[model samples]
Target: MKYAWAAPGAKVVCVVPLGASHDFGIAIDTVMTIAEVDTSPLVKCSVILRFQERPSDCWYAAEAFRPIISQDDDVAMFKAIADRGLAQNGIHVPSSSPEHA
Candidate 1:
């Protein structure tokens, strides 16, 4: 999601990753996921980062989309993703996944 906002009174802030479709594989994200510290709520029971395409504003909060993926460590999760992106281009990304993706 390119942008995110709470439900006005919700304490749980979500990490929304804004993305868009590209010529590659299927979806090519132009920018990385954005997590606002001041407005974003702490990691909680229900939190999901959805890919909100451009010109679209439809979004919602989710507890769990499916029976897969545990977002216990969001930083690690996204860091791995970034690492893969960097490795694909022979770039070094600091963190867990230092080697190739």
Candidate 2:
């Protein structure tokens, strides 16, 4: 699941479990803003929240926040993070993969 399109003025929202609805809760919260579109298209941002269920519910999730980025920047950020993650897990990633091959 990818959400690398939360640009400034972009239409985006969060989904939560129902039944435990809240009367007072922030809907949209943005933590970080990508300054350079050329350097980091998918900038890392987080969301802090105080839920009604548990105190441990205060959590932060990293996101590939994109804001009016170019093709090169988009590809670069994705590829860089992909490479790092794969390499960290001792996995060798090819330049391209086959269709379910």
Candidate 3:
């Protein structure tokens, strides 16, 4: 959930505010850049994101966005799925097996 690693071109899910109904949803966008503004004694940073479906840029706090699945995370998820498939087929997969040395 760390936004520090996010850079330009990185995909992120932005939280959208919904009023009254309290229904909240997320919008996926690509990171444009991080903007820093100096306010006298304080410096504020905002994440600039661009929507994929349209031509628009949104500036929001860094906390409002969450990183999408990373390459390592995808690999681990696929490995888990493969392990489950093997188990379902009566094949044994060691829980602590190393995929690579």
Q: Write down the lDDT of every candidate, Cα atoms only.
A: 0.38, 0.43, 0.52
Worst 10 residues of 3 by lDDT: 34-43
lDDT of 1 at 46: 43
lDDT score, candidate 2, position 8: 32
Instruction: Report the C-alpha lDDT of model 3 over 1-101, residue by residue, as the tens digit.
Output: 33464665556565544122432223445333333311232326444333343334433455666667779999999999998899899998656757642
Candidate 3: where is the Cα deviation over 4 Å?
Answer: 18-42, 45-58, 70-72, 77-101
- TM-score to true structure, per model: 0.24, 0.28, 0.36
Q: Give candidate 1 regions above 4 Å deviation.
A: 1-72, 94-101
Alpha-carbon RMSD to native, per candidate: 14.9, 13.4, 9.7
What is the number of residue pairs that collide in model 1?
4
Candidate 1 residue 46 Cα shift, in angstroms, is 20
List model 1 lDDT by residue over 9-100, tens digit each: 22332334323344221122233221222224664534433333322233333431212233776667887798789899999745444473
The order by descending TM-score is: 3, 2, 1
Better candidate number, 1 or 2, judged by TM-score? 2
Error of 1 at 26 (Å): 37
Top of the candidates by TM-score: 3
